[model samples]
Every structure is written in structure tokens, then in C-alpha cells.
Target: MPTKKLGVYPELLTSIEKARQLIIPEDRIRVLNPLIEYIQSKIDQGQEINLNFICTHNSRRSQFSQIWAQTAADYFGIPANCYSGGVEITAFNERAVASIKRSGFKVSAKGDANPVYYVFHSDDKEAITAFSKLFNDPINKGSQFAAVITCSHADENCPFIPGTEKRIPVRYEDPKEFDNTSEESAKYDERSLQIASEMFYVFSNVKMPA
Candidate 1:
């Protein structure tokens, strides 16, 4: 287990430190295995795996997936690239950003109406750059990337994603419903932890090269 380092908030560090305790159910693991296999296959081929998590608005779940996946990849020492986009351009919601912050990340936002947020999970790790854009945004990998659909709406709507080698539907419940409610903070944190736990499960299970 990694110990807390400087620049990481104490509360957020605690949240991340406890993440390993949340066990993902066996049934959910079945759904996640394909993603694991996909990453492993890419590594076997001496190729870099790029995952783009997509949603209808590029707001909550998609952002969480991208952040967690990247964090997990780094933690597991897997050479994988992670990105997030949507069917339509919309700002990465503040609620999602707040949730990630509570998980021990240092965040800084720039711009508005489509702000770009720099989310740092640790001082030594590269910061994740987040914003809203189309699925094929210029900032993302153009081809040979897996399109991970984070929301059911995006999956059903964008059936054919151009240039993607694989399309994996790993849907998650939207925490947007609890927006502005009393459970906002709790629900958002819950969703973040869920994504983080699953991502940890995925990368942790990967067989490192011999």
C-alpha cells in the first residue's frame, strides 16, 4: 500500500487508501473482464491501449471512468491511455469534479462553459486533463482506441464509433439524479468509489510482463 505523500489532502487520501476494501461482486467482474483482456492483448502486441469513456453529456460517469481508469493504469504500472468525451459537448459538471476531489485529488479548473480541469491524483503522477468535447475530439487518440460507453444513452445512440478498434459497453448508474439533493455529496462519492474500485480490480488483475 502506498503511503500518503505531500500535496494530497488528508481526507481524500483516506478515501483512496480505503478503496481496496470495497469488493466488486463476481457478476460485475464478468462484465469487466473484456476490458481487462483487451488491455492485455494490446500489451502483448506491443501496442498502447487507449480507452475513451463516452456518455451523452460527458458530465459525470464518463469523467469518473476516465479518471479512475487512468489512475488505476498508473497504479498498476500498465501503459494505457485514458480519455472521456460525449455525443454532445457539455462542460464536465462541477459535481463530478467535487466528487473526485473528495477522493484525494488536487484539482484546478480553467475556462467556463466547457472548462478544462486539471485533476491530480498524486504529486508524482501526471495530471488528468478533463473537459467536454465530441467523442472524436482532436485531443484524443484518433484510432485504435477502445470506445468505452459509460452511459446507456450514449451506447444506444452512437452504435458506430469511427476508428475505434473495440467498443466496450461498461455502463454505470448516473449520479446526476442526486444533483442538488441532500444526498449529493454522498451519492457522488459513492459513484466515484464504485468506479475506482472496479478500475482497481481491472488493473490489479492484469498479468505483468515476465
Candidate 2:
């Protein structure tokens, strides 16, 4: 089946092209298989696909996962809604935000301590609203959503997420370790593109209805 391509910002599209070229390791593919199955099952049932990427803090990894997953779904015409949350609320890190900008997303924020960010991947698409909040926050889907654990801390600590249909661990290393170092920007971008690549990989395997 042919994929339905959507319009994306030219520079972001360039990043996507690069993301598509990265090789996901076999072990990582094994880990991602469950997410693919979850999406496929939702599609097979003609149900809405909701994915909530969760981390200890809604600062970095989860945010990246949510944004990239939504983008990949859009690119593949899969109709998935993506969101991110944490066990505890902490503002989305500025470093992560900068990495996203470097990837060609246009971003705007409104707030001080914990600003809500409006991120745009395409001129025509609705902006992805990003901020620090708990996974069960009112803005997030309360039920029938897959809870994707994006960091080891959240995965282990969040043994149970109230409304998730499936809880899948897809951990990523924290770029926080590199904060304040010269490698901060590069490391954050690396993690962002890694998640982006894996997301595109997951959606690429999904088969849409005829």
C-alpha cells in the first residue's frame, strides 16, 4: 500500500529524510515491535490510536517521543494522536526545546516557570501543545491509550498507569547528563533524531486500511 504523504516544513522534512536513513538495532526493533502491534491492533479495530510517552519528568525524552511520534504518524497518514507526560511535573527543558528548533520546528512559548510550548512541524498542521504535566492530567486521554515509557526511571517507578491499554517500555538515554557541557546541543539533537528515526520506523511498518 502507498503511504499518504503530508506537507511538512522543508527543513523538518530534511531531518525526517535523515531520520529515515538511521539504522535501528535488532534489539531495539524487538523492543519497538510491541508499539507497532499496538498501533496495528487499533487500526484493525477502527479505533483511535493514542500514545502517551511518559518519563520521570515531562522535560526531555517523553517530549521528543511525543512530537516525533505525531510527526511520523502524520507522515504516514496513520491518524494517531501523540502526547507526553511524566510522573512529576517539571518544565520542558530549554535544551530539549533548542534541539527541536535545530530540527526545523517552529516553537513559541507562553509562561515562565513551566511554559507551554506550541510546536509546529508544518504550516498547516495544528501546533503540538507541550508542557510539564502528569500522565493523568486532564488534557491527556484518560483511557484506551498506550502508555509508552520513554525513560528507565519512569518505566520502573510507574509500575501501573491507571488508564493505559498497554504499557510499553521504550527507554532512551537522558541527554541531561551532558547539560552545561559543550556536547549539550549535539547530544540533545542526537536523542531527538534517534527517537524520530525509531518513530518513523514504527509507522513505516503499519498497514493502513484500503
Count clashes in each candidate, considering only residues at least 3 apart in sequence or on different chains. 1, 0
Per-candidate RMSD, Å:
2.3, 1.1
Q: Please report the TM-score between candidate 2 and the true structure.
A: 0.98
Cα lDDT of all candidates, in order? Answer: 0.86, 0.94
- Residues 1-210 of candidate 2: C-alpha lDDT, one tens digit per residue: 217656688999999999999999999999999999999999999999999999999999999999999989988889999999999998999999999999999999999999999999987689999999999999899999999999999998889999899999999999999999999999999999999999999999999988
Write down the lDDT that model 2 would get: 0.94
* TM-score per candidate: 0.93, 0.98
- Candidate with top TM-score is 2
Pairs of colliding residues, candidate 2: none
- The numbered model that scores best in lDDT is 2
> Least lDDT summed over 10 consecutive residues: which range in candidate 2?
1-10
lDDT of 1 at 193: 93
